[model samples]
Target: MSRKAHSFLHEYPRIRVDRFTESRERVPDFLLPPRCRAGAAKRQDEDEDDDEPGPWDDLDQDDESTLKANGGVRFFPAPTIQLLSHIHADHIEGLSAPLRSSAPIYCSAATKEMLMRLESQKSREKGACRVPMGEGARKRPYEWLRVTAKHAKAKKKFTGLAPAPRDLLHALPFNTPTELRYSPGVNIRITLLDANHMSGSTMFLIEGHRGAVLHMGDCRAETWWIEA
Candidate 1:
């Protein structure tokens, strides 16, 4: 008898702050907390008597699932699908140009709009001649990352992977349960919850035959919010 393959959730190692100093600077200010930018000298000393946890200290670390989200780079054999919780550049960095996969990318409608705007800005900065849309005119954004010819050639030589198609973007509605066929016999249900961290930020709940997992992507949890 053949044994069933074990499935588990995976996450890429967190990037060290010092390693991406320059890149981190470009991240939007609203995405970072006040303490994250304050130097050691500017930080207030912790009160020994005050044992209360800070705002960002509360987090649930235990969860299980076969589905992966916001971790496209670490999948060696490539994932069948990708889930994007928000439009934050850091979370989507791995989906950048030159590294391609055919997996369908899922995200919120607001996130898709923001990505399209960002891409349009990038195109204009590259001196690409484009006409401004008239009133009520809209252009659909490409789903894949845009790579230069030089980077594309280098990527092809090093990793023989094809570029991810820009047409595979899917937008999910908040709080709606979406069914996904993960494998031949496995089915997963995904629900997107508002994270309240930023515009279009989301928390993913993935439930499968094995177990369920809640993946919080950059969420700001409040006591009241949790108790409710």
Candidate 2:
């Protein structure tokens, strides 16, 4: 729920946002909960493993109630930000519902350490999840661990609360420029070139006040991206 301070991370800047919530309201539910481990049944082998679908799958609830009574003020807006141009497997097929919202998932610190090692290998194939491993006290070489929930949050019959992939994972460093104020009319300013189309690939260049966008996520040619 935190992590939006710039100043190159230090000397003071994250004075707030320990809990960000501005109603990102993005619901085109990619349902995945029938006691997961890919169980939900009916999906037909995940629709033949499709990948050619973008724009959050589906949504047109009266066009989001007319952009929530007209604040999306025209054109394209309400889908704040989520640019993960690497970690292929057909680019993370249907990202389970944008990896469970609170959106802010840029990428590339080796794709956030390969999404924290694929959430610790889905917590060792969950058997109700429990990855208890510690002891680095005076000689630390391994520490970050959180695949918790022997009974996931006091169990309400659980519905997906075991992925702590470094919270909303924002890494972006390839090109620089990074301000992403999620609300107040969604100010942008992303930048992540270097999409040689592989290891930690990236491409988005997006600018501000609903203006520019370069999203070429699957590139190949080089030479500084053909002189950018």
Candidate 3:
């Protein structure tokens, strides 16, 4: 098995469709605590005597799936699952499955609303799936992490091995940008872009050591006219 990547120190081999697979890196220590820690002193004082554990206790374990759900931060891998907007199965089918409960599924606030509306319409029409004449059958948007796993079988002679079906860590956020956050020191950064094609459509800009990649999700680019 490959080793974990260290924080701010590149070690893990690049992950690609045709590249070798490796374990995820540890969440960097510096970025573990929230920025508002100092203001919570009184809250901390009250909790000091309580029997219940604190947030950091949960964070120390370094579970990406859990972190994304409860909070918006996580140390994820490449090929993170990004749900752009509510659409048909072809658009959402291959995305990640649910992870630890209560995770934030990232999307524009409008997209979230659109999904609920779609669900309701589905129930009313008793539609098995997307129905004709239905508007914006888009569902909620969420960010997910895809972890690597070993393939069913491996050949003895090769140093490189194939990975099995990806393990997903789902993160669903009710809002966008501000609600969006990530664990520090990771090579990957995901940013959501507006996909003007639909009411709540979005595009994703993924940046990493490999390079910057822009993925368009049902986007209809607009041509703006400037008169000067």
TM-score winner among the candidates? 1
Query: Worst ten-residue run, lDDT, model 1?
Result: 12-21
lDDT tens readout by residue for model 3, 92-141: 43233444323224456565554434443344464654355433333323
Compared with the true structure, what per-residue lDDT tens digits does model 1 show for residues 1-228? 011211113321111110111121222222223433222223476444334432112112212231124121111233455677776666654443433455566778887777655554544544455656542233323333434466466667778975532444568999999987665554677888988888988887877654577877678898876776
lDDT per residue, candidate 2, 1-228, as tens digits? 112211111111111111222333322123212222122334545553344433322222236456457543222223345557776555544343333344555777887676555533344445235545432112211112223444345333456444443455678798887887744444567788887877788876766543565767577987776887
* Segments in model 3 whose C-alpha atoms lie over 4 Å from true places: 1-81, 94-105, 120-122, 126-187, 225-228
List of clashing residue pairs for candidate 2: none
Better of 1 and 3 by lDDT: 1
Q: What is the TM-score of each candidate against the true structure?
A: 0.49, 0.26, 0.35
Q: Is candidate 2 or candidate 3 better by TM-score?
A: 3
Kindly give the stretch of ten consecutive residues in candidate 3 with the minimal lDDT sum: 11-20
Error of 2 at 194 (Å): 4.6
Superposed model 1: Cα runs more than 4 Å off: 1-8, 11-75, 119-166
Name the top lDDT candidate.
1
Please list the C-alpha lDDT of all candidates, in the order they appear.
0.50, 0.47, 0.40
lDDT, candidate 2, at 139: 22
- Per-model clash counts, in order, read 1, 0, 11
lDDT of 3 at 56: 33
